[model samples]
Target chain A: MAVFKPATSNLLHIEVINAIINAIVSGELKPGDHIIEQHIAQEMQISRAPVREAIRELAAQDIIQFIPRKGAYVAPLDPRNIEGIYLLRSYLEGLAARLAAPRLTETDLNEMYLLNYQMGEASLKNNVDTFINLDLQFHDFICQHCEHSQLKKMIDGVQLQTKLFMNMSKWHLAAHSELHREMNAHEPILEALRARNQEEAEMKMREHIVMAGNRLLEYLVDNKSSKNSKKEDTETVKN
Target chain B: MAVFKPATSNLLHIEVINAIINAIVSGELKPGDHIIEQHIAQEMQISRAPVREAIRELAAQDIIQFIPRKGAYVAPLDPRNIEGIYLLRSYLEGLAARLAAPRLTETDLNEMYLLNYQMGEASLKNNVDTFINLDLQFHDFICQHCEHSQLKKMIDGVQLQTKLFMNMSKWHLAAHSELHREMNAHEPILEALRARNQEEAEMKMREHIVMAGNRLLEYLVDNKSSKNSKKEDTETVKN
Candidate 1:
C-alpha cells in the first residue's frame, strides 16, 4: 500500500500514464476528478498525442473512466469493490507466500527478518509511511520470488486498488495503535514461511490480508458515518 | 470457450479488440502470429488509428505482446503459465461459488441443473464445442451472480488464458474419453449448490477445477512427449 512510483519505462505514453497515476496516488487528483487531457499535456510539457494515448490506455486498464462528451476522470474507490479486492488479494498473496516458501533462500528470510524489525521501529516512532514502505517491500519480496507471472500480476492489480483507500501514507498514520494487530498477523505468516510449511504459510497469509481488509473497511465506514452526522448538524444549523 | 462475440459498445476500439480476440480464439491467428495494424484495418474497413489503439490496449492487458523491432504478436500460451492460470481460477471460482451459494435462487439452481444435464449429453455425443460453451456458461452464471464485480473480473481474465489452449474445439476432439471425467466433476458441484451448502460448494468447485486442470496438463504433456519421440524416430531413420 505504499505510494506508487511511476513506471520506469522509456515509452512516453507509459511515462504519461505513470505521471497521471502519480497525481491520483498523491491525492493531488482525487477520485471522480475530471482529467483534462490538455491540462495533463501542459503539465507534462508534452504533446497531446502521448497524453491522449495514455488516457486511452488507462481507461482500458480501468485505472480511469471515459464519459462520452465529458472526457476522463479517476475511477472512484467503491467500498464494495475494495472489499472484493481484499478477498482476492488474500487468496492470491497466500498462494504467493505458499509458492515462495520452498524457493525462499536464507538471504530472503534474513531480509524479511530485518524488514520486520524495521517495521517494529517505525511503529514505535509512529512513522506510518516508513512502516508501510517496509510492509509493501516485505510483501513485494515474496511476490517477486513467486514463480508465476500471472499470479503476481493479479496480486499487483488488487493491491493497487487497496492503495486507493489506504493511500499508504495517511492510513498508517491514523492507525498507529493497530500496527501491533498487523504485527501479530505478519508473525504467523513469516513463521510459516520460515518453517517452510506451505499449508500454514498460505492460510496465515490469507488470514493476514482478510484481517487487514476488515480493519480498513471498518475504519472507512466509521469515518463516513461521522462525516455524515457532521453534515446533518451543519444542515440543521442552516435551517 | 465459446466464440468471443465482440463488445456491443459503439466504441470502435472495443470492437477491434474483440475482432482480434475472435481471430485468436478461432485459431485463425496462432500464438506468436504478427498482428498487422494496417492489415486488420483494411480487413475491417476502418482506419489504422483504432487498430493501432486496440493493439496497444491488448498489449497492456497481456493479450498481445510488443517486441521492439518485431512488431506485435499474440501472447504465446506457455505451458507453465497455463498451470498457474488454472490454480488461480480454482481459488477465485471457488470463492465465487461460495459467495453465490446462499444467494442463489431456486431458478439459479434449476438452471444449473439443466446445464449439468446438458453437459452429460455433450460428453456422450463427443460434442466438444457445446461442452465447452456449457462449461463456460455454468461458470459464468456463478460469477455473474457472485455479487462481486472485482472477483468476476479476475475470474474472467484467467479463463481467457484457458481459451488459448482449449479453444473449444481441438482439445475436446483429441481428449474425447476424458469428457466423462469432466461430467463426473460437474455432478458434485451441482449437488452442493442445489443443497445450498456453502462450504461444500466452494470445495467442490475448487476440486473440480484442479481435477480438470490436471487432466488437461497431463494430456498436453503426453501429446508433447509423443511428438518429441516421433521426431527422434524420424532423425534415426534419416541417420
Candidate 2:
C-alpha cells in the first residue's frame, strides 16, 4: 500500500490514478481491497485532495467501486462486463480497421506482418508477455491509422479495461492452444488489409475479437463450474 | 467570466467542469477564449486546486486546448472532427438500438412514438429548443434500455461532443426543412423497434444519425462558402 513514491507530476491526480491502477495490475491491490485515500496520499507524500480526485475518477471508470458507507474498493472483475467491453472493442476496432485500410501503406502492412510473425514466435516459445504486448501493438498500429482521434480514444479506453482483466487472468492465454488460436486470428485481418478491402478487413477484425472474447468466456464458465464441483466434493467429504 | 457561484459539491472538479461547459454552451465562453484558472477559482469562491484539476480534465477531453507558454483556451470546433464524432455516434447508437430492440416493450414503443409525435409538433411550431431536448430524450430513452452500461457511457460521451457543437450552431437545426427531416428520421427507427427487428432497427438508427450528420455537414459547408463569398465581395468593392 505504501509502494508509491513522492509525486512531482503536474497532474497529480492522473499520476495517482495510474499508480493505483499499476498497483492493482501488479497484484499489490486485489479486488475488494479498500482504497484509503489518506493512506495513498501519505504514502505518496502528497496531500489527500489529489488522491480523493483519483478515487473519484477511478470509480467513474468502473475500475474502482464505492460500496455506500464502506468506502472505495478495487472493483471486482465481472465476466459479463468484460464481454461487453470486448464487444465494444470489436465494433470500434472493426471501424478502425475499415478506416485504416485505405490509409495504411505498404510499409505499414509490412510492419504489421512483422509484428504478427514475432507474435507467432513468442507464442511458440510460451512468451505470453511478449506475445500479449505485440498483439496490442498490432491492433494499435491499425487504430493509429484510423484518422479519427475520438474513435481511437474510445478504443484505448476499452482496451485498458481488457488489459486489466487479462493481467488478472494471464493463465487463460498461457495455454498453447489458446496462444496458437490467438496468433492465427490475425491472419485474415492482415490479408484483408493487404488487399485494401475495407469491408472484409472490418469483418475479419470483428470476428477475431468476438472469437477471443468467446474463448475467455468459455474459460470463465468452465472455471466456475469446476470450482462449484470442488466445493460440492468438499461438502461431501465433510459429511 | 464571474458567472459561477461558490461550489459546495464534494466533487468540486466535476462542478467546475460542468460550470465551464455550461458557460461555453450558453455562448458566454466562445471558442478560442482563454480559460483563466485563477479567475474561475475566484469567481467560484473555491480554491484554485479544483479549478486546475478541472482544466486538466477538460484538456484531456479535448474541450480545452493548451498552447505551450500560453495556457489553455476553449477548443475550436472542426467540422471534420465533428463528422468523425457523428460517425462514431452512428455506429454506437446503432449498437444501442440493436441491443435495446429486443428488450423494449410495447409500452416503450408507444412512448417513443409519442415523443416523435411531439417532436413533429415542436418542429412545426418552430420550437427548436423543445425539439432539440425531445430529440435527445428520444435517443436517450432507447439507450437507457440497451442493458450495456459501458456502451451507454460511450454513447453519452459522444453525444456530449455533438451537444457542444449543436449549441454553437443552433441555426442549422432551426431551419424548417431541417427540423422536419430530423423529426421524420425517427419514424423508421420506431417502426423497426416496434417490430423487434434488430437489424432493421440498427440500420435505421444508423441511417438516421448519418442523415443528421450529413445535414449538419451541408450547413457547415454552405456557411463557410457563404462567408468566403462575402469576404470576396468586400475585397472586390475595396478594389
Candidate 3:
C-alpha cells in the first residue's frame, strides 16, 4: 500500500481506480487491508477528491467494499461467493459466446486467434503475467464484441470477483501443466464460434467455465482443510 | 411520481432509496425521466443531503443512472438487457436453491408455503400489486436464506434488474392462466427443496426462470416488431 504511486492518466479518478485494482490483483494490496483515500491521495500527489471518487466507483463495482463506520477495505474472497459467481458467469458468458459467434467477422476471429497464440506462448514460457493478461483480453474481447451491453456488464462484474478469488488463492495456474491445460480449454470454444455454431459455442463456453471453476473450487477446499489441520497440528505440538 | 410520500425511517438515505425504488417498481417513475434530488428532498420535507446520498446508493445498485452534468435519470429498460440479466439470475438462483435445500428448516418452508398461497390468492383476485410483492418476497427469501453473502448480493442485483424489466414490460403475469402456470412452476421447486433433493431443486429452479425468461423475451420481440411494422404502416399511409 505504501509503495503504490498512482499512474497518471487523463482522468485522475479512473487512473486511481485502475492503479488500486492493479495493486489488489497483483497481491500488493491484500484482502482485508483498509484502503485509505487520504493516504493514496498523498502518495499520488493529488487531491483527495479523485481518490475518494475512485474508491466510490470501485465500491460500486464490488471490487472494494465500505463497511459502516469502518471505511473501505479490499473485500475478502469467499468460496461460496466464488462458486456462485462462477456459476452465474458460466451462463452469462455462454450467452455472450452464442450472441457473439454468428456476429463475429473475420477480423474479430483474427484478433481472437492472435490472443490465443499469445496465451499459448506465454503459457509455454511460464510467463504468468503475460498469460493472465492474455486470458483477460480473450474474455474481455468476447464481452466487448457481444451484442448485449448488459451481458457484458454482468460478465465484467463476474471477472472482477474472479480476479479477487485468483488473488486471494494465488491460483494463477502458474504451473506449466495447469497453464497448458487451461490454454487448451479455449480452443473448442473458439472453434465453435469460428464455425458459427451458436449452440455449440454456448455449451463449450459454459463447459470451460464450469470445469475451471470446479478445479479452483476443489483446490480452495483442499487448501482450507489442510490449513485447518495444520493449525490443529500446531496446537498439539504446543500442548 | 407526484403521489409518492416519503416513508419515515431511521436512516433517511435508506428510506429515500426505498421510496424511489417502490415508485419505480410500481411504474410511477418511468424510464428516462430525470430524478430531481431537490424535488424529492422538498417532498420529503428533509434536507437534500440524504436525497443525494440515496441517489448515489441507487446508482451504485444500477437501479438508477447518473449522467455527468445531466443529472440522474431512470435508465431505460432494453430487451437485450433483460435477457442477459434473467439468464444470469437463472444460474445464480439455481445455485441458491441447490445450496439452500439442505439448509431450509421447517419454519422456512412454512413461510414459503404461506407466501406461495398468498401469491395464488393474489393472482386469483387479480391483485397485481400483492402478487408482485409476493413474487419479490419469494425470491428475496431464497437470496436471503442462501448461505453465501456474496451470492446473495449477486442475486439482489439480478432481482433489481428484473424489477426494472417487470416494470418496463408492465408484466405482472396478469392473466389468470399465466399466473396459474407460474404458480405451478414453483411447486416442483418447493417439493424438491422439501425433499432435500439438491439436484432436483436446482434443475427445477433453472427451468422455471428460463421458461419465464423465454416468455418475456418472446413478448418483447413481438412487441418490437409490431411497433416497427406499425411505424411502417403509418409512413406508408402518409406517403
Candidate 4:
C-alpha cells in the first residue's frame, strides 16, 4: 500500500478521493490492487467513514470495483478501456482545438507555447513528472478556452483516467525517446492555432492524440506476454 | 408544481432523483424553475431529507443549479449548452456505430430497422411521444452493442439531457414536417450498418446527429427574439 498524507481540509471524503486518485496517477497504486478502507483511514489518521465514502465515490466513477464478499479493488484495466479513453479524448480535444482556434487571444497562444516549450525541457531532463504536468496544462489550456463547459468537464475526467492507467503500465518509463517526439508534435497544433486555422488545428490535434494512443497500445502489446507470465509473481511480491 | 408519485422503494433519495428527472423529461418541469424540496417531499409523501439529497445529486450532475440563499432551480437553457451536448453526442454515436458495424448481429440490425420504421409510423400518426421514444431506442440499440462500455455510458447521460431540454422546449410541437425528415435520417445509418461498412456507418451516424442538432439550433434561433420578449410573462404565468 502507498503511504498517504492527509490532504487539504475540504470535505474529508473529497480529500480522500484526491489522495487515492493522486496515488494511482503517480504509479504508487496499480490496477487490481486491493484497497482496504481501514488501512487508508489509519494512514491518513482519519476515520474509516470518510475513507469508505471516498471508495464508494471512486467506485461510482468506475475507478474501483467491488466484488461480492471480496471488497473493493482498483478497477482492472483492459486495453480497450484505454483505447476508448484516448479515442474519446481525441475527438473532444480536437473539437476543443477547433473551437479555441478562432477564439484564441495572443496571450492564450503564448501560454500554450510556453507550456509546450516547458514540456520539451522536462523531457530533455528526463523529468517524467514535470513533463506529464506540463503536458496536461498544454492540453487543458486549449480546452479551457474552448468555450464549452460540458466539453471541458468531460475532458478533465477522461484525461485524469488516461494518466492513471498510463502510469499504471509505466507508460512514461517505456518511452523516453517517444516523449521528445510527442512534445515536438505540439508545434503543428501551436502553428495552426497561431494562424487561426480551425480545420488544421482540429485535424492536427486529433492526429496528435491518436498517435499517442497508438504508441501506448504498441507498448502494452509488446510487453503483455512477459507481463502476463510474471503477473502472479509480481502480485505476490508487490502486495 | 408537477405531481410525482412515490417511486420504487429503493433508496428514497434515488427515487427522488428519478421523479425529478422524469418530471423534467416530461416537460412538467421547465428550465429556470425553482425546486422546492418541501413541496417535493409533500408530493411524494416522503421526508424532506431525501428530497434535499436528491437536489444535491442533481446539482452535482448539472441538472440543477444553486444560487446561494436562493435555493435550487432547474438549470437554465443556453444555446451553446444544447449545441455542446449534441456535438459531443454526434461524435460519440458516430464512434459507436463504427465499432458496432462488424460486431452487430442479424438480430441487432433487424431490431434497429424495426425501431426506425416504428418511429416513422409514430410520426405519421402524429404521436410525438411514441416517435420520441422510438427515436431513443433506435440510437440506443446501435450504441448498446458498440462493444464499448465507456462510450455507452457517455451517450446515455448525454441522451437523457438532450431529451430533457428538447422536451422543455416542446421540440416536437414546432416541427411536424421535420419529424418525418429526421425519421428518414436514420435510414442511411441503418443501411451502412447492414452493409457492415464501418467508415460509412460512422459518417452517416455523425451526419444524422449533426442534422438533428442543426435543426434544433435553427428552431431555437428563430424563436429566440419572441421568446426573450415573452420570457418574463412565461415565467410569471408558468410558476
CA lDDT, every prediction? 0.76, 0.81, 0.76, 0.78
lDDT of 2 by residue, A1-239 (tens): 25688888888887998899888888777666778877788889999988977886676566788654568998767777777778888999999999999999899999999999999998888888898889889999998999998788778777767777677558767853467767677989999999999999999999999888877788788788666422222221110
RMSD of 2: 6.1
Leading candidate by TM-score: 2
lDDT of 3 by residue, A1-239 (tens): 25558457767877898889888877777666778877788778888877876776677667888775578998766666677667777877887898899899999999999999999898887776787778878888988888765567667877987766755544436642567777777899899999999999999999988888888898788778656422222121110
Candidate 1 lDDT by residue in tens digits, A1-239: 21223234667777887787778888767677777776666666666777878888777556787776689988776677767778878888998998899999899999998999898887777777787778888888899888987778777766666666668336644555666555545778889989999999999989888888888878777677655422222111110
| Native contacts present in candidate 4, fraction | 0.32
Q: TM-score, each model?
A: 0.87, 0.88, 0.81, 0.86
Task: Give me the runs in candidate 2 sitting further than 4 Å from their true place.
Answer: A6-14, A53-60, A66-71, A175-177, A226-239, B7-11, B56-60, B66-72, B175-177, B228-239
Ranking by TM-score: 2, 1, 4, 3
Winning model by lDDT: 2
Better-scoring candidate (lDDT), 1 or 4: 4
lDDT of 1 by residue, B1-239 (tens): 22224345677777888888888887766776777776677666677777777888777667788875468998876777767778888989999998899889999889988998999998898888888889889999999988976677667777776766677335645455667767756778888888889899999999989877877777777677656422212111110
Residue clash pairs of candidate 2: none
Which residue pairs in model 1 clash with each other? none
Residue B95 in model 3: shift from native, Å? 3.2
Ranking by DockQ: 1, 4, 2, 3
Badly placed stretches (over 4 Å) of model 4 are A1-10, A34-61, A65-72, A169-178, A229-239, B11-13, B36-61, B66-72, B169-178, B228-239
Chain A fold similarity by TM-score, each prediction:
0.84, 0.85, 0.85, 0.84
Error of 3 at B176 (Å): 7.5
Task: Give the per-residue lDDT of model 4 (tens digit) for B1-239.
Answer: 44678656757878898899988876677787889888788789888877876776566456778664579998888787787778888988999999999999899888888888888897777677787778888888888989877678678767878787557445445354456666587999999999999999999999888878887888788878766633444453332
